[model samples]
Target chain A: MSGVSENRVLAGSPSTGEAARGGLIADVPRRALILLGLFAALLLVAPATVGDYLLSVMILVLYYAYLGLAWNVMMGFAGQFSLGHALYIGLGGYTAGALFVHYGLPPWFGMVVGAAVAAVMGGVIGALGFRFGVKGVYFALLTIAFAEFTRILFDHWGWVGASSGLYLPVEYRDTDDLWLLRGSATMFYYVILAMTAGAFILCHWLLQRRVGYYWQAIREDQEAAQTLGIDVFRYKMIAVMLSAAMTAIGGVFYAFYYNNLYPETIFSMHRSIELMLGVIIGGIGTLFGPILGAIVLTTLGEMLTGLTEDLGLDGIKQMSYGVALLVIIVYRPGGLWPWLRRRLGLEKPR
Target chain B: MPIDFLLNILVAGLLTGLVYGLMALGLSAIFGVMKVVNFAHGDMMVVAMYATYTLYTAAGLEPVAALPLVAAGLFVFGFALQRGLVNRFINATEHMQFLLLLGVAMVITNGTLMVFGPDARNVQLDYAFDSYNVGPLIVDKVRVIAAGVAGGTALLLAAFFRFTVTGKAIRACADNFTGAQVVGLHVNHLYAVTFGIGAACVGVAGTLLLLITDVHPHLSTDYTLLGFIIVILGGLGSLGGALLGGVLVGLSEALSGALIAPSLKSMFSFGLLILVLLLRPQGLLGKQA
Candidate 1:
């Protein structure tokens, strides 16, 4: 029962408080709704209250939360382990970035186009793997293979600037250009915040629906799900496609926010690892877990960076991060959200 | 362009493949026993390589002379890692196991970066520039010696598995986890020992690699994927398959680097992997799943 814990937890309380009943805000228990409402209000005013630097950090936190939420749809929900998620990020970013740079297409339109491309790529990979019944670690390797192949191809292709990297023309301004994704930090923060909140709601909605239940069933036992008349392949494909499409949206933001992209950095195994670290560290398959994880990890990571810089321990910085992660995983393999949920009174103490 | 030049490349590729096989041999052994692909396989090897490099530089000990000490040290490190950290995750989800090993790899890799300062270090032996004349082929002396040493180590590993009681116990555990446990085998201790042996094989391979390659922290990154590719290509748990897969991959690299662009060499390997995975997922010599 690798995922039985998640299934049990999600069944009792999918997102915030315990309630299998359907409907939005009204369906949530009084306490969770209040807490979520307060959290949302805080985020809405955060841009104005926080300094520019902290605002930027919050933007990153939201961005990572969005990425984690997107990734969780596939792995946490569907139990399909994709280790080469950077492939989708690269696909989304490059698709949008290339279209904008070369053809002068607006990023809003490019985002849609990027999502389609990413979905197609994810479909191809999922088909290759699922059709052959390549599950577990071997399936993970297949994802990496596709990602590495794409990276190599991009490195050699000069059309998208090749290994020299792709750069987007930026006109920094106070006024926001929503169409072009050109705006201030606050504007970007709101965009990512919207995406993260929307993704969380969408996941919660899905989890309580037929599709979500099917995904959980499939996750818990594929053979059992198949015997119970579930179209295992179709649901799995939906998970892959939906996750890929959402991840592409994050990639679109990454391209514009960073204003430059290198194939190596974009498709590197490092990107894939970091993208899932939030979900893994947070409660996998839980609604607020990715959000909590994104905040804790990004904040702590930033703190670690500053602390190391101040103490002249910069060299051992990553080593320290690695060691800390090990300790955390060893102590809380189920994730930090469950522990925090008890304190928050979201769930009864066992 | 010339035939002799082609022959030289072929010989060189085969020699390099032998070393690659040795590196993968260790990885395959670990997976054979534990069924957990040691994500830190390459970095653990890097630890041995760095130790070998230090021996050569600090005390003027030859890499060959210090091989035994370095291998033994890696064995202890691997055993301790399994017992202390990885053992907990043996029964955990695949994702947890992957994350745990990845954390270990990051620690080892970044720790090396911190200590080694990211400089690419190399060894300069007397015969570094020398090669042997074998008819139309001119093979590097260092490559030949390294290959011979690798082959010899592989044989020693075989004999260890075949003859030693501890080695036999480890093999039995791999064959049947519950069966071994039912027979009153110390499974945890045996698992640690298997991990240690895996690390030692990598230690042997890394020392030989230090003879031909420049040592660097980042070198560990490429080797992890490379080891996985070779291990998969050979056959999941088959030692002989790993060697054969290594040679094929090595030759592919050589041929592709010589004929096509060097950047595209990895592309060829991945392509071959996808093809094999589709056609025969069991690997070239792997038993039917």
Candidate 2:
């Protein structure tokens, strides 16, 4: 019964949504594959060409891109705005880091548990919000409340080092330890690059599947989808849970990469906002949009820093970021990806 | 807990809540009229505080003395903001609106930091340590003055909205956007006026706040969240509700701080916000959706 409805939804929407997808599927698969191969090859050898500082910047860009992809699953695809997504990142990072720090467990083992925990957290938020018929901004507020409440709880909970912070043992090794997940910056960079690629593929596959169609239908109109026999509560829950789980994996990487976690910084609203900025500025719900956004935003931010540093300005870089964001949002509400597609004559102009 | 000790906490909460009520009122007013959440609500208030600070440092003027001047400045600022930037996005999606205001918030915060740096700033007040003793209850003089001033502004705001022609016109617009347009109301001007009033209210609130607490650019986000929580608790559009909600939070925070760890006070406040949101989202005095 559900299968028939899923097919109906799939057949019904994307025939039109395909155009709105920023011309992702409009491209020939062969061209996309070639481009993907070239992009991946360049990233693989990027460490050799770029200096350590540039490599670090690239890592940040990719890291945020990974988070943006994870966040896009719930927000962009499903049309559920989560203002407190930092909660998932903090939870996953802390859970995995704590397990590794306290019990000497490998991060791979810890990440599984971390992802599960984040999924459950996401589920709880979904159940409470969706069941009560909270929609749009109200739902966003609910997420923020839960995230802040959790942050405060963690702030006082002595188990995770309370407000002081959680730190892991630093191992300066020349060789990469894949099992322990401790290694050089190059190793970490490769790991994150691989993760970013995986996230994009996973999103693409999900969009092709039945669930993705249901999500797009729901995002377009919840009531209409419900009238069509789609289970609204369940699909929304799945999106939230899956997104949370993926973000937690990023969290595990963040904990190991930073070697320390503070509830203050990790669970901050600023972090939540920063992660999604790329998605909004690039192309929302588009697979390659976040990657491009990450690259543009990070590079722009670096350039601004260079300009601001000579003048020794305290917050000018941030002000420029704010100004830049406004300009992009005002000029390209459909995001840079769709705009780029039009410029390259790959997609029709809106 | 001893009764006097409890009363002391209660008094403290009430004092803090009065100021919070005024701040939330500013946010609620803008939201009520425009139906758009001012994400930069708190940052604008912080800007008002800086205005007050400038008046103090440059001319040795008291915040009380500079209140009207700062509020007028904020009114102009808010008016320009709504007319220039926010007006373009009124018809846009909610996501775009949020992003736009978040951008505004970032610019305001960073710009303030660029000019003032990160250090906390304060004024040297003559009545800083003075207190009033009534029987067994002791209250700080500065807090009482701040609270009193905040309460007065809220009253003035309520009266303005209730009695003034422009205020009624704004309310009519809130009641029905298209009808107001059909009736030939200059909605854009009214919107700018409503936004200016909201900003001016925050100016009043921020000035009073500076009388009691120190000011910095980063404190604005906390205020923004606090305002939202209060407005939600009191009900979204109700002027009276915002005050009630503010008092509730203030009392709860005071109680939690005394009963639990001081750091966990915000946990209780957020907990109440969640409960209110989940259980009775219309808020204590809000109209049903």
Candidate 3:
């Protein structure tokens, strides 16, 4: 999406733009291959090199990156900003967790069910909102209201343990119960890494297709896209459903990894914001922006936590998030990707 | 429920509704002129609450007495906020405005948390607990007085918008940003003024709220969400609509809390919001989108 937009935006500088496009077209496959290689190498080598704590942090980074990618598919690619994406996460987590806990279904099956459930939920929201011509902030608010309603519903639904939260058994009997989702941090880390890599590849594939072009067109201008023979509504719905399904996978991972699901934490507005922060800071509408954003934010967050712990400041984490977002939005609204691309001389004309 | 009990609930709901209206008025006003939803509005209200709390705690002023000072303080804050941050993105996309205001909200809420240490603070007035019995209803003195102030302010705002030149200018901007610009309206100044007035409304609400509830950094989101509900229900930018919407929401909440579980009150309101969006997208009094 960013690629398409950047071409039009940077067209003002014909030379640089042309050069950048050329460079990008040449660089795309090579960059992808290199990134995959590096990721694989890191995946293989990191568990051995880093301590358990660091491994856990890496897992968190990957998890967030995956979620950010899912969110980016909707807001960045389709330009349908959903403020309550945590709805999908929560739905997925609860469904998978409940199945695992109550029905003795393995997370392997539960995860798929969770994803389907989230997709359906997303479909309902998108249908109701779009069918009624709700757009802009109204659409955003509707999403929020739905999320809040679900949160409240979950809060009272005792089957999910109500507000006390649904807890999954964390007793590790065997370290290699892959089907059951019982494993070491290393096992979970590897699984999450696969998922993150898969998500990135999926986004790349989608962005390369006709659907991706349609999404980008709709995002750039809905009316123009419709006039150009694009089914804006169907495309938007697909974007939402796909995004929700992907987010559900993350939620299932979270449920098993964290071994607990609370309506408050899972469905909180803060959770939605956290997922979006990565996409926003990294670069919306770009393939690797969410990954880059996840890394930077997680590293900064850890550093801030450590600094605050050392200084005995209780709420610096929240404060820092605000300051960072403000600085990014005000000074670098296009986010770090374009700037990073320029700095690295990777600004392709294609 | 018995008639008297229902009546009591109605009175209580109406009082709280008036407060909600005042809480939402500033946001409505700001949206009217700028068409931007100020996500930081709740945090601004928290700032007002803290300001009022400080006045009462440090200076021994009554919460009601501290109202003007808090209003003035918030007015300045809102003015500067619009001029410095919001003005830059005034013409930007709705998403940009949202992110900007969200950033502002985060800064204000977290900044307050850092400074105030997450402690809940409230001023204690002697008459806060005092109540008067009328027929079969009991009304707390603080709430009644707060309700009166809220009602009075709503009326004043209505008159201001109706008669005052500056208010009319703000209205003009709300009515048509481009047309107002063509007519030589100082859109920027009017935006700042509108935001200031909105902040002042929060100031008034904050003062009244502090009499009954504690001020905490975490509460800002709740206030912000509630304010959004009211604004949406009332129709964005309509003063009377805000009041009406607030009353309806407040009544719904109170009745639900009494008739159903206390936990479901918020859900009810949020559900109503979804219903409204689907059924009546323009809201009760809002112009057709």
List iRMS for all predictions.
2.2, 6.6, 2.9
Per-model RMSD to reference: 2.2, 4.1, 3.3
Kindly give the stretch of ten consecutive residues in candidate 1 chain B with the minimal lDDT sum: B273-282
Locate the minimum summed-lDDT window of 10 residues in model 3 chain B: B110-119
When only the first chain is scored, the TM-scores of the models are 0.93, 0.91, 0.91
User: What TM-score results for chain B in every one of the models?
Assistant: 0.97, 0.97, 0.97
Point to the candidate with the largest DockQ. Answer: 3
Give the C-alpha miss distance for residue B114 in model 3, angstroms: 1.6
Q: Report the C-alpha lDDT of model 3 over A214-265, residue by residue, as the tens digit.
A: 8888988899999999989999999999999999999999999999999988
Model 2 Cα interface RMS deviation (Å): 6.6
Calculate model 3's interface RMSD in Å.
Answer: 2.9
Candidate 1 lDDT for residue A46: 91
> Model-by-model lDDT, in order?
0.85, 0.86, 0.86
Candidate 2 docking class: medium
The Cα RMSD of model 3 versus the native structure comes to 3.3
Please give, for residues B1-289, the per-residue lDDT of candidate 3 as tens digits. Answer: 6999888888888898899899899999898878889998899989889988888888999988889889998899899999999999887788888888998898888888877877889887777789999978888888899899999998998899899998788888988989999999998999998999999999999888888789999888878888888888878877878898989998998999999988899999999899888888777998877
- Model 3 score (lDDT): 0.86
- For candidate 1 chain A, which ten residues in a row score worst on lDDT? A9-18
Question: In candidate 2, how many Å is residue A242 off?
Answer: 0.6
Off by over 4 Å in 2: A1-29, A348-350
- TM-score per candidate: 0.96, 0.95, 0.95
